[model samples]
Target chain A: MHELSVAQGIVSAALSHIKGTGKVREVHVAIGELTLINAEQLAFAFEIASHGTPLEGAILETRVIEARLRCIRCGREGKSFTCEECGSAMEVLAGEELLLEKLKLVEGDGDAQGI
Target chain B: MHKVSEIEVQEDLLAANRELAQQNRKLLDESGVTAIEVSGAIGSGKTTLIELAAKELKDYRIAAIAGDVVASLDAGRFEKLGIPTVPLNTGKECHLDAHLVSHAIEKLPLNKLDIIFIENVGNLICPADFELGAHARVVVVSVTEGDDTIAKHPAVFRKAQLAVINKVDIASYVNANPGRMEEDARKINPFLEVIQVSAKTGHNLQRWFNFIVKAVEDRKQHGI
Candidate 1:
């Protein structure tokens, strides 16, 4: 599955940002509806990719964003490509994003929390 | 007691691939090679369309990079057509990434080739996510795959610059409506150029060839 490669990307990104100082607690990723990525498959792939890495045992959390299209003629925004009011062709404004949003990490120090 | 912290880092998952794609695009431009990525599902007549195009455009120096899971059957087919073809065995990867294309380009005689066709691995979904530094992205969907094939895979249609509904000669035999397929493709991407051609009978193939020639001319003139 292509999700395996995507999962590996997330782990690589997370590790680069973490700087190997903390244990990864969770990875927050945003997947758009248009991306058609299966969350379960991505999570499973992340587990395999993060194996023996700093992200080992870390949780994978995905937030799905619904696809939104904006009509070019009427400037109407909706989910579908056709506008309800003007019935004109819509332009893709949002969605189709596969982003690594943030990382939740537990610091090695007992009390010092790094942000 | 462990201290938890949130690190704010916003990065696109495909950032790495996109960066490599940009580099590949620059390389193609510098080499003056108009690269087209031909993507479609397996048995969608991609190989036939390419073979016909290569044969018709015999005056131009053309090369091809055929991508497959394990076998180089498509590469061999192109080679037999007198086109210098490179076989890229992806080996379990569902799609061809920009990194693979970059390496393939180095193996080719870039200065001697005018047009390079990168026949992507036969899968509609994964290839849509990967950009192989092609000046034009062509998605081929045959009538035998059913009329709803375009509607079923809107993502690739939306990303593709041109949509070729191939095997139109057998549309009736296959019970597929080419008109509906064209309509669906346009609905998904209003700006997409939809062409219905039978790679077998060579129907409307001149138009396909003309499109590529015009695209190359435009790129050279406009430096796009």
Candidate 2:
């Protein structure tokens, strides 16, 4: 499944992120409309794929972006599926991406002795 | 007071699948086997075309990977023809991705094969999005399905290296136009190699076979 591959990427990214930092608690991802990733399946796949990695217990946070298209015939700028003036098929200019937008890591130990 | 901290990381979600697809491509190239993947809606005669290839490729070692969402009937059909087949059951997934192929290779002896025909699940929209380690993706359409299917699903035709118009023997019985279909396919992808065939009567099957053999030889000569 594509979800398995996506999960593998997330696991590898999380492991690399933690390696760069000291620890990782959560990872946030922004998936655009065209990626067609099922969030629930991706989460399940991530949990299973991360079982042997350093990100075993890490959490996955996701944000979905709506698909946006631009009118080719007219210079109209709006969020409608088709242009109101010409009603032609719009080109997908944006919002069809699967990006690892953010990662939240622990910088230092909270149980430090210093005030 | 509690402190809140966040670390930023940017990554690509399709990185793993793309990497694996590249590896599969390298494997296919090195093995000298032209991996051809065919896609179309159900009952489009993809298996029949594959059967034609298997029958004609007498000198070469041919293997196949038939993918279906539920059953392995297509793969079973290939196996009946004495060709080694690896059945891929995708469960609920619509298309066969690269990782599934990478795993299917374990069951197939790539070193002994010259051609690997991957008959993708019978669907147009979902299969277009995946790269299943194929050297060429061929799309099969039938006269019974109407000529406007290419226009309705332009992405599938655009992604395919070849477009096959099958079931021409029944064209007169169904009022189908081959000329318009070819035009629509070319409009979607001008470079698409279009072939008309009928698996029932074996018309133009030799041309399809010639196309496959020539494609394999061409790829071999170019070292692709």
Best by TM-score: 1
Give the TM-score (vs. native) of candidate 1.
0.92
Q: List RMSD in Å for every model shown.
A: 2.7, 6.5
Q: Write the per-residue lDDT of candidate 1 for residues B61-99, one digit (tens) a residue.
A: 899999999989999999998888889999878999999
Q: Residue pairs in steric clash, candidate 1?
A: none
Docking class of 2: acceptable
TM-score of chain B of each: 0.96, 0.93
Best by lDDT: 1
Stretches of candidate 2 exceeding 4 Å from the true structure: A1-97, A103-115, B1-7, B172-175
How well docked is model 1, in DockQ terms? Answer: 0.53
Question: For every candidate, what is the interface RMSD in angstroms?
Answer: 3.2, 5.9
TM-score of 2: 0.72
